[model samples]
Target: MRRESRVERSTSDMAGGNRFYFPTKAPESPAFYTGRAAFMDTVDTLERAISHARRILSARQLLPVPDFARETFPATKPQWKGMGNMFNVVGTRMRPKNYKKITSLLNQLAECYNVAHVGDAPSVARATKNVLDMFGRVDAPIEDLEGQKKPVTIDDAGRAYARGRRKEASARVWVIPTKTTDNPSVVMDPEFFHEKILKSYRKITELPTTSVLINNVPLAQYFVNPADRERVLRPLKLTGLLGAFNVFALSRGGGTTGQSGAVAHGLAQALAAHVPEADLILRRALLIRRDPRVVERKKAGRAKARKKYTWVKR
Candidate 1:
């Protein structure tokens, strides 16, 4: 007696006139359904179970399924086509609780169906790792953690105010626009004066003169050194807004150098606040930076910071 081939048995199992004989139901056990139909049926069952779980969880208000998951894993006919795409059904808004529940259900289904035999679907271990990695991430909130305050202030009189510090010295400065009628000085043109009377009564508008007062004293009297005077006025000259506004500063502590530097810094910030357009220029020129340098302290074995004792071999 000779054994029959698989083709001969399949042909004989078909109906007399029909070309196909579809199974009414899936195999009882996972091992029996190891073909394409088995894989498609398993995928379809998992999809249905997920949908049902989502509805139940949503109705109970336990876990609300995200919109992304619904859009990605829409209900479709059970077919072997695109079975591998089922692994892409991760939810975007599922929190930790929902993630745990869904993953647990997935693991249970994988075990029941022996999903390990289906090579097309992602492995249960890999999917679990990916899901855990994706949902574990959290975005940080954006905020000003340092609580820094602005350097400039405005007064009721429309004046720009600022404070500056340098080496134990600090200055409070205010910049205000100058009024044309404040000073009625005339410019004497040589040509007109020479042709007419030596002293004619011709009133002409003169360039505005910037007046800077420190502690109720004139800037010239306060800072005797020409270099100190220039340092304090450098911010105005650099911005080409000299004589555009009046500066009233109150500086104390430290010597002339520190006081001048502090006043310069304050004036720069006040100018930036008043003009608004010259902020970038003043910032680039480094006039707004507070000097961080300080006098070095004396060491135990040295007279000064690095000045050591006289070398003695004895």
Candidate 2:
């Protein structure tokens, strides 16, 4: 045959060698992707990872079983609620835009895993490391939910005690079911009663009337502002156990607002202790967590915190 050009010879040889012929190129580096493309790719990868994690956690019994069977009262037949609110207690209901959904999912899984494997230190540690690795991937700071909080306990005297803080204020609170024999006559600040609150107490026939005593003073006298009184009573009001329990609080540090908030926090915890079911409600209301905010310290040049000294033209 007449001398074929080098390219023509190679092409014919490649074509004749196989039914299909294609050029192979090196894989594109991640850095070559545009910002949007990179972001989209990362999101997709993370979404897949989240699904994988859910499956792994479910297999490990660290997530709630989706199809739990509940027995009907009269029929006593096991009924599947059909995926039945798997995230009723934990996990986010938000759409997966960025990291929020995945963050909550991983965090809750980690918590459940930690709680479930408390005795198995080696496995718990490994699981924690894996969870932290996932959190790092998402640039999230994982909460230390490993330790199971001690279950709220009741004293032999039927009282639940809890401590709470807000700003610089701290409070020690005790809650007890109102009883027929528990007398309020010995209170040091008996003159500081609120008539409206007392009226509400009287209206509660199903449960004994509730009373609030702060430092041996009636709540009304302890908090002169009606708003402060309301803040202190909010937890009880939300639980609809306003007149069902007695609250005794000893508050120290900070101002009236802080003290009221502290007492409210303590009251919420105490209520949660007394009524375990109310814990979820209080948690939803964010009453169980301590307030981390405080009065910002005054800087050297500032008049008060961020308030700058009056600027004047030279």
Candidate 3:
């Protein structure tokens, strides 16, 4: 009893070569055999694929590689973000099915990684094939499509014009670059300024100011509702072209809401025309399309479009 080393104690417990011994202190747990094995396998497969793709994509000097390290599962956001940027650069022309499959696979991989790390193997195995497939094709080249549309061009007036309609409202919008102005300075109406800026200054004396006019009135003054104002400015804001152009819109055949919507649609079209490159952004935002919804006519016997009066037995 003077001293007994761990090795000696372990050897004493396993007296025979045929029998195995587990120390009392080292309690047996299913996690040792079940969770870690599959988790490490899945992670290893994914990590290898990711590394291989990264090496292949390293040739793209402009694309920065995502930071990936072993056991960094908890911090996978940057990896996904980096992957997204890379995908944008090379996945635009990828077959829709492939694109969707790859996206789903990445999502599954993230989910499976989390679940597997927590000792759930069955759940993680569900999407293993999909995740592997995604990792395999992460570096594939995008295919080119035929007959690409030509970019829109600005007119002689240096303005792009578009028409938009919403409900009974219709609008004609024109967008012109602020840089084309011959005047050295532009005098803006007090109401045109944002509330935050308006509170600090009586008047703004600035060059190359963006102006939005609706029916010869400033945007803020015309669209009193904040929602309406936001709707009118959404296209520009989305394109990061806000305050870079002058917008003139003539809206008719609708109230505030309709008119605002019409102007927004028109503005979006005009912006697309001015900056042909931004057409994709405008299209995705659904700002280029004319809203087809209109008010349904009231039925003669109904309270409103589809409502009927409650029956009262006499």
Candidate 4:
């Protein structure tokens, strides 16, 4: 046989030998040529796969016809719809015509029972009339229930009463008006025969002096502090009624300061009661307001309120 040509020999050898031999006559590098061919083949395969998938998707768009087996046996009606009006359909359905008649009968029965057991129409009319008559009998205004339409007035004793409190101290105070004559009358008489002439009759009016007593003791004696004494007397001074009335206060509880405040509050109230016009003045001066300040409670693990115990690591 003639010597085999290189191309044919290589082709036959490749067909008979291992299928993975690299070709020598490739123009570009073998690795690049093989990779390029593999990439092109892969691109073709992907395009074919995409086209096939598109065809399947287009076919799926058409609706499926019902099978003969399914058409032979149709679905049954829903149980709820079949049950119909036998079951009451509350809010969903229109009320039956008998509902109105039933409600009317119930209302009539209730009215009849009320008339038979409670009373007849004429008796009801009489009861209503009685109520109207009773309402008509009330002639006085309802506000009169608060007894004593007028402002608080001093009794025949000429004393005004009031109560005051400050902290733990409380005082019951009474202010009494004092009577004083403004002028004095004197008359001299001459005796004719009798040895001694009768002493000339003289009537004198004295100026009233105001005094403040606390628990039956003088204010000065009860309250040692000058400030406390001044606080107790502040209300009278503010109202310009210092010498007008004598104050007797029974104060209990709390210290001297609190007692003084309590007494002042009581005196203010009494002054207001004594002279209604002074109410505005006393209120403006804040004498009528009760002091709300109190001592803070001591917290646990502390020496006193807000005072922490000293820590010493020994």
The most accurate candidate by lDDT is 2
Where's the lowest-lDDT run of ten residues in candidate 3? 183-192
CA RMSD per model (angstroms): 26.4, 17.1, 21.2, 37.5
Q: List the residue pairs that clash in candidate 3.
A: none
Error of 1 at 49 (Å): 42
The residue-by-residue lDDT of candidate 3 on 179-274, one tens digit each, is 734421121222334653567554446424679999999988988899999999888777767666999989999799899999998888888776
Residue ranges of candidate 1 with Cα displaced over 4 Å: 1-146, 181-205, 312-314
| TM-scores vs. true structure, each candidate | 0.46, 0.46, 0.43, 0.44
What tens digits encode model 4's per-residue C-alpha lDDT throughout 108-189?
A: 3222222322333444334333322321221224444333234445678878787889999999999887564121010011
TM-score of model number 3: 0.43
**Pairs with steric clashes in candidate 1:** none
lDDT of each: 0.63, 0.64, 0.63, 0.58
* Residue-by-residue lDDT tens digits, candidate 1, 1-314: 87756765676567553445445796765645544444344445556655554454445443433555445432221111121233344412334454455545555433322222122233443443333333221111223222234658768886888998889899999888777423111111224324433465445445455799988899999999999999999988877666677899999999999999999999999988877677888899898889889889888988789998899899
Model 3, runs deviating above 4 Å: 1-153, 180-209
C-alpha lDDT of candidate 4 relative to the true structure: 0.58
Candidate 2 Cα outliers beyond 4 Å, as residue runs: 1-149, 180-207
